[model samples]
Target: MKIAVVGATGLVGRKIINLCEKYFDSDVDYSFFASSKSAGSELEINGNKIIVQELNDDNISNFNISLFSAGGEKSKLFAKKFLDKGSFVIDNSSAFRMMEDVPLVVHGINEEIITEKTMLISNPNCTTMGLVMALKPLHDEFTLKSIFPTSYQAVSGSGTKAVTSLEEEIGLGDDLTPDYSDGFYERPIAKNVIPLAGTLLENGYSDEEMKFVNESRKILSIQNLIVEPSNARVGVKTGHGTFCSALFENNVDVDEAINLISKFEGIEYWADRLATPLDAEGQNDVLVSRLRKGLSNDKILNFWVVSDNLLKGAALNAVQIAKHVSTL
Candidate 1:
């Protein structure tokens, strides 16, 4: 089988390449693509050196599957080109996610939506991906009525420049007098938290916050499900954390919920200790802790979820979808 990895030099793209080796067979043919600026660079895969090609109309190849993380604009231009070549396009961008026909999938949760005829799939936002992974299992058993989530996301989710900005801010030591001239974020991201993570819309919610509401409802097949979301950018570098409170139609049992979360694939439940972003930095599974009954009523349940935004949130989810298509 032949596979293509676009945006091969990016933060998420590099992780996807690393995970392709882990999830796919050794003999599968792999091709890497990047923007013209990053083109001609070489990446090692399976004991061989592979050169990254410039992503353009001329370089589109006939492959079995193509994973795109080059951003929405590039995906809008190139995804269907790969699709017309008879390739399955699993996009890791916001481009095709909300389209009625495109299946927005989080691999292990609702991947059954993918079938023989479905060719283009969209991976969810990194924060939404981790949030839904924990919510799916509970929603199935308790029947979710509403979701209230506040996300604490890391700078890595904003790309390499944001990560560099955080590092630069941290380098100033105890002095907070540095000019905010060159930073990517609106506020200092070193020892601070920004309440708004994405572009603010007319409705007063950021794009990232709406992704949690809209994408989760679509993935779970709940069109009118009530969701109130807030996203904050934190000082960390890897994991994305969410403190979620959900209301269920039926009564929730804490023991049964823990049991269900533990058995679900790609999730780890912590009953004895609290799970934090530090513990979830390099793990493939979403970490859940501090599960308890909400103070308002018996039907409400609250929990904390964390995961590696680069791993399970982005690259791991995209590659897993490709693996599923390969089996068919």
Candidate 2:
């Protein structure tokens, strides 16, 4: 199989390259594609030096599959170009995710929706990816009435620059000045919490928060699923934690829910230990812990979920989508 990775210079892009070497068999061939400024550079993978090429109209047909982690604008502009050239574009951006015709997919949860003929696949937001994985098995049996989620997201989700901002402001304990340079936040991220993650849209919900609601609805195939989410940017460098209090249609027990959740393929459920963001870093499974009864409602329950935003949430999901395609 011939694979190409757009945005090869970015963090998620690098992770995807690493997975190709880790997951794919020795028959796989890779072509790294990035912007013109990074065209002449090289990306080292599995002891091999792969030259990065400039992404353009002329070179779109060079692979059987292309993984894109550039932002939404870049995916909007170029994803279909790869498809037009017979490449399965597994976009890791939000660009095509919400489109009605486009299939928004996670590997084990909703992967059956795609086949060899599926030309374009949209990867869910990193937070949404982890949240839905935990929600699926429960929703499948008890049927979810509603979801209330609050996320403690790592700075790395905002990109490499946001990671730098957190590193740069580590010792600025009391300096409250805004660090709006390359970071998503308009305020200091070190020792401080920003209530926002993505840009605030017209509806007053930050784009990242809305992703939890929208993507959850689609992947679960529940058109009317209700979700209320709050996304925050924490100082941590990786992993995203989602704390959700849910209401089900039936009265449920914690042990029963854990058993159902354990039956799901991509989630690891533990009742004895608390799952932290750090626990999920560099790993592929969504970790579920802190399960308990919710207040004020017999049908309600609360649980904590965590996963590596860059790995299981983004890069691994994209690679798994391609792996499904490979089976076709």
lDDT for each residue of candidate 2 in 1-328, tens digit (9 for 90 to 100): 7898999989899999989887888677888888898988999887889899888888776579999987888898898788887899999988888888889999988889997888999999999889889888888778987899999999889888778778777745565466444444677777777798888999999999999998999999988888999999888889999899989898878888999888888899977778887788988889999888877877888999999999988999999998888888
Task: Give candidate 2's root-mean-square deviation (CA, Å).
Answer: 1.8
Report the alpha-carbon TM-score of model 1 versus the true structure: 0.98
Q: Candidate 1, clashing residue pairs?
A: none
Candidate with top TM-score is 1
Total clashes, candidate 1?
0
lDDT of 1 at 196: 90
Model 1: per-residue lDDT, tens digit, 1-328? 9999998888899999889888988998999999898888898777778899999999897999999999899999999999999999999999999999999999898888998689999999999999889989999999999999999999999888888888988897687443566577887778888889989999999999999999999998989889999999988988999999999999999999989999999999998888888999889999999999989799999999999999888999999999998887
Model 1 CA deviation exceeding 4 Å by range: 177-179
Q: Please give the CA lDDT of all the candidate structures.
A: 0.92, 0.87
